[model samples]
Target: MIDALPPLREVIETHGLSAKKSLGQNFILDLNLTSRIARIPGDLSGADVLEVGPGPGGLTRGLLAEGARRVVAIEKDPRCLPALAEIAAHYPGRLEVHEGDALEFDPRLLNGPVHIVANLPYNVGTELLVRWLTPKVWPPFWSGLTLMFQREVADRITAQPGGKAYGRLAVLAQWKAEARVALTLPPEAFTPPPKVHSAVVHLTPRPEPQFPADPKMMNRVVAMAFGQRRKMLRASMKAMTPGIEDVLVEAGIKPTERAEQVPIEGFAALSRALTARGL
Candidate 1:
């Protein structure tokens, strides 16, 4: 048995908690699954682990048991607080529970040298990922992001060039981090099971992105290009300028290629070209 906390089921039942579908909650009641996710980072000995949507403290307990120096858990659901409080009590000063929305929380202000490990709520997973990926600074506050997402979302995040699944997400995530699917879990792993299977994704921020380009510019170019993904760049980028072909030439990209076929570096070059053109 993993030490440092009570079993999650006892905590949940004691707190009168049931997973809420409205909040996109699919509680991981299985201690084994939670332990696996908590251990995905390889070693957590002295790391400050940031956990989001720690429903019933299943993952939270695992983090402590796995030897995290401290855990700062941000949870929006008030109903789950009692359960988390029990874990906090069991662990003493090692656990810090924040009662608020994670999207609005700034990790920089909390503590230094953080590592994010969470089984993110399905509804806000992608959006939260984009926010973390687009920070104004290079080498974000957290050491790395080890998160769980629906398997489909995981594929899109780690997808390579020249595929239907490859798009803005692949470009953005690949540009700044090395993301890989660490493990996959079936839908039956959870209490109130989600329809889609889940996967744990480990994303370590690179010291520098493969190509350095303005993030705002990259977002704009990718949005425009992938917005009409089926069309060639000459047709898709028509709104940017009538000389869209010239822009592609300057960026060292083939105007005939569709957005999905281009690598992340190609997109970075396009963003740079667009910036130079003042577009």
Candidate 2:
């Protein structure tokens, strides 16, 4: 056991904390598994960690036990507060729990070097990741991210060009950070197992984007191209500007290439060409 406190199963039974499907809650009761997830971000000894949807504080305890300097956990569910409070008391000034939507919580309030590690609520995982990847500032507050997502989403984040899984997510993630699937967990690992398996993705933000392009414009370009993945770039992106083929040629991209066939650098170049033409 990593802690002197009662086992997670006992805590849940005592608190009557059954997993709620509405909140995308799937509690991991095993400390060993939670601890292993915590260790994936490497040494947390000197960093403050940000966690979201910490249902019953399973990963919270793992972080503390693994020696995270401080953990700021944002939990939307009110039922988990008392259980998390128990952990805060156990750790004595190491764990902080906030009862609210993680979407509203601001990590900038916390002192850096912050590393975000969470068993993210499945409903909001992709949205949260997009927010983190596209912060207003070039380098976001968090130094790294270790997040759990459905296996398909994981594949998208780590995918390369010319694959079915590659699309806007791959472009966005790879443009901003170095991302990889660090761990995969079976469905049975949770208290109320989900239908699909989950994987943990680790991302380290780059000092700058892989290539320079207006952020908003790049996103718009990517969105338009992938909005019809089967269509060639010329057909799919014609709505982007009057001279789409000229723009594609200037970017060194073939107009006949589909969105899935265009690499991140290719998209970046397209974004730049559009910007140059004042699109």
Candidate 3:
């Protein structure tokens, strides 16, 4: 984890950076740990990396030291600009820090096939993932995603059918990508430790989806089905459009089946069938 730079604690002190509860910031002051996280994406030497919320540039430094070709980092907090500038100067054009909210920024601005690696802000983690995953295009802007989230959310993202954790997130994540929990960290790892443990999730875009279906309808169908997860599909999806039972039958899913019991393929099939019916 040792590089030619000063330690993260010194950098934080020098920059006068402190964790902000409103922004969901928990600065990880350990460069050794940050370096380990940076390597999670594996050989970013040829990759254009995009990092969200690079507070004090701890992980940004790690990414550069770990051989990322270039990093386009988006950070909303203006206070960390000075510290990030120092890291950029040290790396000499290897890093570019943008002052903006990642929630509204355009990933298309970065180079093709970007790799998103981050210790995400807790408050907006799932919202960002939904935006990235539900893009209009078949293949997304990013080629790969290695992100940190609460352990509970990680379980939900990688969950499968017929499990307590399985639901809308599980469907959307696994439908078009391969996702898994790569690493787990204790609460004490952060500057001001969060209440729950954190986990690192690695996701790679699939060359093809689980099945062919209209993207908008696929998401809508899945949302409606899981909207009342405890109820049978025939009842839960009734309000989305008419002929709910027929749609399930066309998809080869039983009308009596609940949302949690249906696989991703089933949802895709349902969406395709619904689109065909022009409903």
Candidate 4:
């Protein structure tokens, strides 16, 4: 067991802190859980880590305690800085807490090899993952993402075809990264416990997507197709294509296929066709 960091409950009480709903805070004080998450992305030693919404720094402490070479924590809510600062002091420079919004901050701008680990603020978790997956450049800025999301969202992120959860998120995430469910934490594990149970998902970016497609067009195609997921591709993509059957033919997808039935490559092909037609 790691022993460097103090008990997270003590840290929270000392800061007179409670999770703030406005900030989408759900502080996980369970060292066991946090440590388990910290370990999900493999060896942390000598790796730079980007942590977001580190309210009360439980996961931050776990990352550092488990020997991450450096941690840059971006906490959106200013109220949590003092609590995080205490952990920074405890670790003596291994931790760097940035009091700002992680969404606006570009992880690519950070110095070196980075892995992202966060018990993410629920409101922005899916958006954040999309941003990372479809960054302006391919082969994203982070080495891996070990993040906590509502169990349902986690299911969608790592879901397979033929499942209700499979749709745009599964296509996008799996197209660019290898994703899997790492662990699940009950509601009671957090300070101001969230109504939903949380699951940790680990995603490693793939060197190449299953198929080549323009990122912007890919996003648009997925958005449009899944925008009316129940409809067949021929109907759903009709707005952009009077000849979606032909487009599907050109891409080797079937006109009758639904968005959930098509895998990542199918979306990539559609994305490429739309880009080719300048849709």
Candidate 5:
């Protein structure tokens, strides 16, 4: 046992915390796996970690046991609150449990240099990642992110150009941070195994984007290019501006290239070219 607290299974049973499919809950009862995830972001001794959807507090306990300076857990399910409260009691002031939607909670309330680590709820994982990556500021509030997602989603985040998985997600994530799939977890790792496999992704924010481009324009350009990915850039991005071919030429991207054929740098170039034209 990592602490005097009862085993996770016992705690879940005691609290009547059954995994809720509606909420996208698949509790990780294994302390070892959770601890391993906690350690992925390197030493947490000096970082305040933000955890979302900590069903039954399994990852929350791991975060505390692994010596995170402080852990702020946001749980949407009210039934899991008691289990998390027990963990908070075990660790004293190290853990804070908030019962609310993670999407609604703001991370800016937390102090600087925070590291966000979580086995994010499946339903909200991608949306949350996008939100974190596209904040108004260049450098987001959290210094690093260690997040778990469905294998397919993980592939999209870390995928390179010219692949089916490489699209808006790949462009957005890779443009904003250094992303890679750090670990793969089998379906059986959770209490109720999901149909698909899961993988953990580690991302460290770049002080500034690898290439210069307006974030809003970049998103617009990427979305349009990938919206009709089967079409060449000349056809798909024609609506972006009247002089679409000129924009592609200015950015050094071939008009015949598909969205998947363009790398992050190429997309950023397109965005910059559009901005330069006062679009």
Candidate 6:
């Protein structure tokens, strides 16, 4: 909390940095708020933190102030580098800034258990989240994710079956991880307010999936079901494996059920049943 470095506004002005709509950037200049966000990932006493799209490094400063052992920040906009560099100089070896696209940047390059927390760019937020959700390994490489998404997307992630927001995203998120809406940020919190409010979601990977099913089969079942969401399972799954109705019965899912009405466990069960039949 005792960062003697220049104020973020001065840093932004000095670097000629302006939030860009094209890059989906919305800078948060408030140090107090940023610090609060940094603490959301729990006690960072000696944790390795991964941050994305750190425009002007407001959250980066917060992270260091809150005691992150090491922070690897990925920034695509070169304009923000000078501001981030200033913070790096102040914090010494605690901060590392990488100039590249976050989507292409790999977290495995850094050592230790990573706690990814960021005010992610709006445009690529959902896609990035999906990539993190479906990592090659179970229990994921990162210990957890504390991410900011448009509130609507957050709703979709934490949404349950039978809710309008429930779909493939909800199924995938809830099945493999324990996710919840941790906080909500009004549009005014950003430099250039977006049309909708933002939400912070915390997802802790489950040691084991809520139910057992092959990843590929589970994803395929989820995609097909939600893709044809409006249709019942018997009708929608017609294009999928044959004998779908029998599997639904075996999985204890109603053949007449629609995608939105199916629970995560049911989908996993149905996927296991389907794959077991060699379908």
Clashing pairs in 4: none
Q: Rate the local accuracy (lDDT) of all candidates.
A: 0.89, 0.94, 0.90, 0.86, 0.92, 0.90
- By the lDDT metric, which is better: model 1 or model 2? 2
lDDT of 6 by residue, 160-279 (tens): 899889999999999889999988999999888889999999999999888999999999999999888899999998777677898898999999999999999899999988888887
Residues 1-279 of candidate 5: C-alpha lDDT, one tens digit per residue: 777788899988999998999998888888988988988999989989999999888888888999999999998889988888888888899988888998899887687679999999899999999999999998889899999999999999999998999999999999999999999999999889999999999999999998999999999999999999999999999998888998898899999999999999999999999999999
Candidate 4's clash total is 0
Candidate 1 matches the true fold with a TM-score of 0.96
Where model 6 places Cα greater than 4 Å from the true spot, the runs are none
Q: Identify the candidate with maximal lDDT.
A: 2
What TM-score do all the candidates reach, one by one?
0.96, 0.99, 0.97, 0.94, 0.98, 0.97
Off by over 4 Å in 2: none
> What's every prediction's RMSD, in angstroms?
1.3, 0.7, 1.2, 1.7, 0.8, 1.2
Off by over 4 Å in 5: none
Instruction: Kindly list the per-residue Cα lDDT of model 4 for residues 83-123, writing each as its tens digit.
Output: 78878888887888888888898676566688999989999
Superposed by TM-score, candidate 5 places the C-alpha of residue 275 at a distance from the truth, in angstroms, of 0.6
Q: Any residue pairs clashing in model 5, and if so which?
A: none
- CA displacement after TM-score superposition, residue 22 of candidate 2 (Å): 0.7
Model 4 per-residue lDDT at 65: 82
Return the candidate ranking by lDDT, descending: 2, 5, 3, 6, 1, 4
119, model 2: CA deviation in Å? 0.4
| Candidate 2 per-residue C-alpha lDDT over 60-168 given as tens digits, one digit per residue, 9 for 90 to 100 | 9999999999999998888888999999999998998888998888776688899999999999999999999998988999999999999999999999999999999
The 10-residue segment with the lowest total lDDT in model 1: 1-10
